[model samples]
Target: MKAVRLEEIEQLFLREVERPVPGPDDLLVRVEASGICGTDRHLLHGEFPSTPPVTLGHEFSGIVEAVGSAVLGFRPGMRVTGDPNIVCGHCVHCHAGRINLCQNLRAIGIHRDGALADYVIVPQKQAHELPLSLKPDYGAFCEPLACCLHGIDVAGIKAGSSVVVLGGGVIGLLTVQLARLAGATRVVLVTRQASKRRLAEEIGATASFDPTAGDAAAGIAGPDGLLPGGADVVIECAGVAETMEEMPRLARPGGTLVVLGVMAKGEKIQIEPFDILFRELRILGSFINPFVHRRAADLIISGAIKVEPLITRRVSLEEVPEVIRNPARPGEVKVLFMPSA
Candidate 1:
């Protein structure tokens, strides 16, 4: 089996490795499609915590090549997506139903061998079924969509509510669609990329904004601006310092601000605490998919959320290392690795 291994920080390579076998409650998944995420880059640079000498693909889906004896509902031929994050059930957070915040958390790609190879082992509890009839590439999106769904759950979007998504990447685009589905009538997408802005509007954004053109704050919340008095909810998905600073300003007084972006560890950004205090704003941070993976799978299987447009291109497993080594290409939403390509 060929796997892309993060040997250590700043050291990544594609090498041949022995195939893995499933344990009593695990499934051996033959890698089909895996999405390259920004976190992969962060992990390569040691910006995010991860166990090195491991495969680094968390967003993936594949056909079950084999199943453990203890596995119940799944068979060898089933198509499934893995919830990479594994939690210790006895942890305080997990016992309280907050698995995402588990004190002893181990993620599939980050902590162990993942789906970036010919075979990866998934605990039966982490496997979510996907329809065989669905597009193979789309299944990989279930992981990201699950995380976005968690953000939507945190934002508490309502009918006729206004939302501002502060990035045009896959997460932002997915968040835009979910906001609309959550009944937000005025969904605004802000990004510097012209193409992503257009795509956001096509998908669900009622309008789009170019933050580089002019004062983004004034243009979006000015008296004659799109939202006029700011939006009911502002979700920061860019994960950049600039966008993080602009998030609170984009939300109306007494409105909500949800941070779904993953900023680099030890990074610093300037924000005004007085504004949040004066406006009585509600701010929250949304982590990974807690209990939303099943719903994400359902949405993808039912075609409720459009993912075909978010896929930029596909590459072979041989190309995975270089793709992770370099920065993402301009306007590239999602670049997937087809293991069998």
Candidate 2:
């Protein structure tokens, strides 16, 4: 088996490695497709804390090739996508139904061998079978979509609510769709990329804007205001300082600002304390998707959220390093690595 491995920071190597054998309670998957994430970029550049010498893929789906004796409710040849966040069931967070915060959590690809190879093993508890009608590319979105689902849940976005998604990346795009489904009458997507902006409009955004050139939020609530104050909810998916700087302000008084992006280690974004009290704004930092992998799988299967537009590239396992090295790779919104290709 060939796996994309990270031996050190800012370095990724494609190397041949021995195949993994499923242990008791584990299911071995012959990976078909895997999604390269922003986290993968962080892991590659040593921005995200991760154990060294780990296979770099977590958003994935594949056919079950083997199952441990202790595993049940599944068999070989089943198509599946699983939750990568392995949490300690005994932890306080887990008992409190917030397992995403489990202190002893270990994720596939980040903390263990992942699906960036011919074979990947995960606990049977984590695997969710995909419908036969679902394609591999769609399954690869289960993980990220699950995270977005969790964010929407935290946001409490309601039908006919006004929403702003501050980023047009895969995550931001997904949040836009989810907000619409949640009944947001006006969905505004803020992104600098024209291509992504156009795509967001095509998908479901009531409008898309390039925040750098013109005032997107301003256009919504300027003197000739489309919205008087601001959106009811603001989901910040841009892991940059500027968006972080503006999240609280763009949110309407008594509204919510959900932080969906992973901030760099030790990075700080300034926000006025008085604004929270006077505006009575609700600020929340969402972590990983908690217990929503099943919901994500079902949502994808039901076609509740269209993921086809978000997939921008299809590459093989061998092509990953070069794709990661080039930031300007054309149409590289969400790159899916087909390990079996």
Candidate with the greatest TM-score versus the true structure: 1
Tens digits of per-residue lDDT, candidate 2, 205-263, equal 99876777766557665555455688899999978888988887677889999999877
- Runs in model 1 with CA error above 4 Å? none
Model 2 pairs whose backbones collide: 159-183, 160-183
lDDT of 1: 0.93
Which portions of model 2 miss their true places by more than 4 Å?
328-331
lDDT of each: 0.93, 0.87
Q: C-alpha displacement of 118 in model 1, angstroms? A: 1.4
Show how many residue pairs clash in every candidate, following the order shown: 0, 2
RMSD of each: 0.8, 1.4
**RMSD in Å for model 1:** 0.8
User: Can you give the TM-score per candidate against the true fold?
Assistant: 0.99, 0.97
